[model samples]
Target: MDDGKMVRALVRAALGRALRCDPDRLPIGLKEEGGVLTLQGEVPDIAAKRRALKEAAAVAEVRRVADQLHVKPAVRMGDGAIRDHLRDALIAECAFQECAVRVRDRGTLESVRTPIGTVRGTIDVSVDDGVVTLDGSVPSLVHKRLAGALAWWIPGSRDVANALEIAPPEEDNDDQITEAIRAAHERDPLVDAVAIGVRTQSSVATLYGTATSEEQKAAAERDAWCTLGVDDVVSQIQVVPPTAPTRETRTA
Candidate 1:
């Protein structure tokens, strides 16, 4: 039968995985009565204890999470001080320069910038010893990764929880095709050698190069034709005289 003991055991098992702690090493007690679950544990830090409570709350039949968990001495930190440090660390990370996320009061997130505009969101920062938990949402995946990377660079941060979601990069009508064309041009040795200028519109590649012979002009056009997605090539190559001009003075 699924009873309180079973519920507590399940909660401990789940939280062990969530916080990446050994299940046997995690000291937790679970009690359930009247469909409510009470979680008791001595977690290394407040973050781990909170994670335990969250895991219990997600249990199939858990009505509520009574977080009676205690913080172990080894990993405890002053909540206010930790928050302030996190704020300073986040702001000081040079990689986050010009980023939309605002850090304040340690790890409390104030605002996030996005293409649409600023977003109002609450960020919870919990520190256990030196590990940091960044729980918040930004606007896109790029922002999420950026914030996580920044968090890791903080002086005392040993780990980070990146629970942010940001919008994907915008889609432009011709961006992919244009990028592919550029990549192809970059890979070709002839494109680099001849001091050629290539511009593409509607899959048609226009190549302008300084060619001194018909052979050089043909070779340049052929290079443009071979590039994938280049449906047509308009050669605007100027083939100047290969030999230098000689000045002549006539004597009467």
Candidate 2:
């Protein structure tokens, strides 16, 4: 019809194709004017809302994306079903094989010993009003984070409260903690370990160097914070564009 209408139509078509899965369940509306897209509608969960905005932004000529998508549970799931689904999902993931998932009532508490260390604490999962709370202790911070992420992946999970604590490990000096942080950065595929430098002092780890993007910088800091003996993490990493010239290569 008109230029604005045509742009809206193109963005809508692209979003429809991107959200092919459960299109009926996820209903989204779009408005585009002057290359800006505004998304409005209800999505099944946070992931679907993010996907809608991301797809709209990917459309050609789209300058900016405004997200007005609401999160509504497509299907009301009982606590038991949510628990079973979360447990199965965690078990299916290779990273969480060692951790066990237990579903409990909102007020109930349970304790279990972790297989990694002789750490005895609670690893309980409870659901209330579609909010999942992961409360307990784990031998390592990785397991604690994994539990929270797995809970979020479950359907009908509106929010997650990860209160899992890391059990005390044998005391390690600052040098050992620094090496562990370095090794962690190297192991993560998203982080450029060569560009990151890790240092630890009095159980506090500091990350210094350049990262390709903000996400990479955050990941490097997260890896450092997740290290066993790290009490805190200070991120001094700078985000540098790949095309930016280095100081050594720049000529006056």
Candidate 3:
């Protein structure tokens, strides 16, 4: 077999081997060129989307995996609503307070500048279908990752195409993802991040600690996966309900 065909086969096999992806139901398509494989299709959820990308990138012949995968939204809405929400998310984000916001409206772009301070950079948001694309640039990799993570949080966001580039092009590592995950946990009211500890190794985040309930545990896991560069999430969180305090009776 030719090199191209062999690489494609290996990638497909890798995806099929991953147990969490529900390989039987996965309808993702693959394309390969110059050792780079591209994944294109709709996935059930964010977990499945990240899992598919990780599996495809793990192939020996695949040097990099391009993500074109979209997660199915829980609720359906028009493209305009998605654009507005994504734009608001960027503006309201404290880290992005210095960044300008723009949106694509009926082919015309509406620009919204922050009055707080000088514009460090801009984040252009455009939504097509359910996919949200972030363009322009940022001051550092941390800002880029934070913007990407926030985009994924918007409801009905099928996929976040984070194209935000760093102005000075800073180096990146697993620490970036770990920090992003921790920040996400802190931002999310659903998660009680005080008891949860985060550790990242090779793009995999392990969340270990205790949650008050099952829902909180799951929320913590979801926060980890939402961050960019997260290949997989290892959740070691235990659920322990809070106990009522018992007071000793005083004898008169």
Error of 3 at 126 (Å): 0.6
lDDT of 1 by residue, 1-252 (tens): 567777767777897897887877767777788988876756554345555666778789688877566555433345555556656655554433444444444545555332234333334456655555666554433334445444443444434555554344434223333343344444334444336666778756677767767765665664454333344567897876557545553332
RMSD of each: 20.0, 14.3, 3.1
Whichever of 1 and 2 has more TM-score, that candidate is: 2
lDDT of 1 at 44: 58
lDDT of 3 at 124: 86
* Per-candidate count of clashing residue pairs (backbone under 3 Å): 8, 1, 0
Regions of candidate 1 where Cα sits further than 4 Å from its true position: 9-26, 33-40, 45-75, 100-139, 142-165, 168-252
Question: So what's the TM-score on candidate 1?
Answer: 0.34
List, residue by residue over 9-104, the lDDT tens digit for candidate 2: 777777667667544344887777666778887766554565566667777777898766655654678876777677666556555545554557
User: Per-residue lDDT for 18 in model 2?
Assistant: 67
Candidate 3, residues 1-252, lDDT tens digits: the string is: 999888877777777777344454557888887777889988778987888887787777888888888898877878888887777777777888888888878788789765465878888888888888889999877788778877777788898888898887878898877887888888888899889999999988999999999999988998888888888999999999998565653332
Of candidates 3 and 2, the better by lDDT: 3
Top TM-score model: 3
